[model samples]
Target: MQLDRIDYALLDALRKNARLPNKTLAEKVGVAPSTALERVRRLRESGMIQGYHAEIDPQALGIGLQAMISVRLERHARTDVAAFDTYLKTLPEVLSFWHVAGGNDFLVHVAVRDSQRLRDFALDAFTTRKEVAHIETNLIFSFQRNARLPAPPRD
Candidate 1:
């Protein structure tokens, strides 16, 4: 579905705050509340708008450190990759992971209590896994997110 200027405006407003009231959203997007509601519904149906979520502080949840680990797999077979992916998902420390095309098969982001826990997690999680050929971990001192997405491509 083609998105017009109004759609783009609505998307921008929603990205900054998904909890915005329908009336507030409509006002920001310069449309009637009913129109804004319908447009948002259409966006969801088209899969343009995914699910909304809250951004919680990891520190508050006892996460004192975060790390990004690069993993090289021993085997690149579909079964081996799938199994490792499944195991990663089961780990509560795992925030997210990317299966990428590069020197590493996967880049995993994890949150832990401290450096000790981070080391233990790496040894227990990746080092012990036979599928993992090699692994490297880097401490994350800070992180940031850009709320607004770039403008969509023109037809």
Candidate 2:
């Protein structure tokens, strides 16, 4: 869908707080509640609004540390590569994983209670796999999210 100013306004409002009711959203975007609801529906149907989720405090949930594991696998075959990707998803500590072109084949974001668990994950989960050639784990001191894009300059 081609987004007009109103669509951008609605998206910005939703990004700020997805829990906002249609009534409040409409008020913020200067539209009727029904219109806001329809627009939201259309946005979802068009795949512009992927999904809504709450931002939780991992620390409060007993997760004290975050780490990124850069994994380089020896596997060159497609089947083996796919199997590794699927296996990564089953690991509880894995928050996200990316397949990228670099010295590392995969970059994995993980969260654990402490450094010991991180070490355990690297040794037990990754090193045990014969296909995994090299693994580097880095402790994350700070993490930030760019939740929304800045609006285009006014014409």
User: Whole-model lDDT for model 1 versus the true structure?
Assistant: 0.95
Q: Which stretches of candidate 1 lie over 4 Å from their true place?
A: none
Best TM-score among the predictions, by candidate number: 1
Per-residue lDDT of candidate 2, residues 1-155 (tens digit): 57888888899999989999999999999999999999999999999999999897789999999999999989767876797899999998889999888898899999999999889878999999877899998889999987685875676
Residue 78's lDDT in candidate 1: 100
| TM-score versus the correct structure, for each prediction | 0.96, 0.90
User: What's the count of clashing pairs in each model shown?
Assistant: 0, 0
Candidate 1, 1-155: lDDT as tens digits: 88989999989999999999999999998999999999999999999998899998999988899999999999899999999999999999999999999999999999999999999999999999999999999999999999887978886
Best-matching candidate per lDDT? 1
Cα shift from native, residue 41, model 1 (Å): 0.7
Deviation in angstroms for 137 in model 2?
A: 0.9
